[model samples]
Target: MYQAIVSPQEDKFIAVRAGQQAAMQLPSAFYAELADLTDSDGVVPDWFGDAARQAWGIELADLPIRDVLMVRAPSVLPVTYSRASWEINKGCNFSCEHCYLEQRPFAGLPLPEKLRLLDMLRDMGVIWFEITGGEPLIDQDFVPAYQRAYAAGMMMEILTNGSRLYRDELLQTFVVNPPHKITVSMYGASPETADALTQTRGAFKSAYRGMVAAAGVGLPVEVTLIITKHNVEELGEMRAIVRDLGLPFKEYGSISPTYTGKGTTLATQVPGLIGKSEVFQGCPAGHTSFHVDPNGFATMCKVGRDNPISLIAESPQGLMRLPAIADAQMLRTGGCSGCKLSATCRVCRPMARVYQEAKAPLNHYCQHGMKEEP
Candidate 1:
């Protein structure tokens, strides 16, 4: 992996340390010079070495260009973006009750097609790439796909359950390439509660082992404590486990229906946590970033997956239609249209639509939900 990445962010340019947040802005002339030197396989310029050392305290004065820098080419596409999330596959090793994916099929594009999709993402100037799934680590092509994105100077993040992270090969690859973040969900503190929640024997043992292994290597791992009725009793123990591992964690108590409007998953949501989310603030989901499904279908985001554009058929050109699609889907229609509480509504239009379709009780998503709380 390269030491740093010099890339375009909107109209300006920036140089950032690999897998870190340390960044320095560049002048137009400086970025122009770097662009001109893209093909030159020589030493990193003396000026860059000084800037990097000053900004991030890294030494790179005499390193070869190929070794020190991955200079990303500016995107020429009309619909340019700097961030995206991809579902490598919807398949997972464990069957969690709170999973939002109604169908977790173990299928996706072939390796070559996956590579082509990654290249297209690179060409679109996407730098912050999130690879998630029912569990991303379980995908067969995850490593190569991750490597390709990392080589393209994208700061990668993986969303997984930590079940498969104990594998030596996967751990070594992560240590070497170094994702910007690896977010894992902790089901429970013990095997009985966690395994019962996931419906997989030894689920807690495997997940806990993986977390320990990742922590031992000092990988950038963060835990998410999934709070459901099954594991609610172990909340304190769960927090203690993550604290003992010296890992940071956040709680997720408000579960939602499946994206396809199935309410089965919502049954796992904590009653007290319902309607606790922050009021609806506008998002930049399709304007500045988007999501891609396993089969190369691009959508506004995971929740508002209406009128998906086939990235395989249109390639990067399909993204040109996303902004308008996002706007259309975000409009407050159907049950939420012209409501008096629209200003204080908690969920987005697409999300509320799903809950309405699922026939969920008003106490789950509506502002009326808060009023119903006794």
Candidate 2:
């Protein structure tokens, strides 16, 4: 495995180390020169060695390019997105009530097609990649697909439930090729509460064991405390558990309807814990980042999935339409079209539409509901 990666992040070129924040900006000419080199070439440019030494305190002058660094192939496509998230599969071992995905189908592209999808992502110059799922680690092709993307120099992060993190196979794979981070969701501190929330017997034991195992091995692990009505009382205990484990944790109390506008998931929301979201600001969902579903359809983001383009059928060329698609979805259409408080509305137009479609209570997302807060 290579120690560093040289790739394009939008308009700029950078050399970044996997699992580390260390990075150095590279000149456009230097990036061009590296991009021109064939993948089989073993030549290590002299400037890279000096720069790497100066920046990261590593010696690479005498090593072959392939041995020292993975030089990512520059893209010729008009779109220059550097970040992307992939849903490896929508299946999970535990069935959580507040999951955003209404349907947790155990299906995705076959291994060969999954590899092709990874290739497309690499060709699109995606440097920061997130592999998520109902539980990504449960997927059969996850290891091979992960290895492929990591080899291609994409700094990867896995969003998982941590139920399978204790598995030796996964630990070995992660030990070999460390991901930039592994984020695990903590539902509750106790088995009774967690199992009830997830509707799975022994769910807490497996997940807690996995988190402890992963942390014991020194994997880059972070915890997300999923606060809901079922487990809200255990908030302090969950924080104490995470603190004992010596892992960073973030609390998430707000819940939203399913991506397909199913409102059932919102019933689990702890209204008292739902904090007001920040005011709407512009984002770079399509211009600098995108999300890919299990079947290889690319959308601006996970929430604003309007017109998805098939990355498998059209390949990277289809990305040319993404920016326009993203921009169109951002328009305040429907009920929000002529709203006076559009500027101060916390939810984006696409999210607001979904909330409306779900027939959710106004206070759940709309500014109208926020104004009624006591």
| C-alpha positional error of residue 369 in candidate 2 after TM-score superposition, expressed in Å | 1.4
For candidate 1, write residues 1-374 as lDDT tens digits: 68888899878898887546678899988887776666776777889989998887889876887777888888988878888999999988899998889999999999999999999999999988999997889888988999999888998889999999999989999998988889999999899999999999999999999999999999989999999999998999999999999998999898988889999998888887888899988889898899999999999899999999998899888888899999998898987878999898889888898899889898899986566546
TM-score of each: 0.94, 0.92
The models' CA-based lDDT, in order, is: 0.89, 0.89
lDDT of 2: 0.89
Against the true structure, candidate 1 reaches a TM-score of 0.94
Backbone clash pairs for candidate 2 read: none
Error of 2 at 153 (Å): 0.9
Root mean square deviation (Cα) for candidate 2: 2.4
Worst ten-residue run, lDDT, model 2? 35-44
Residue ranges of candidate 1 with Cα displaced over 4 Å = 45-47, 372-374
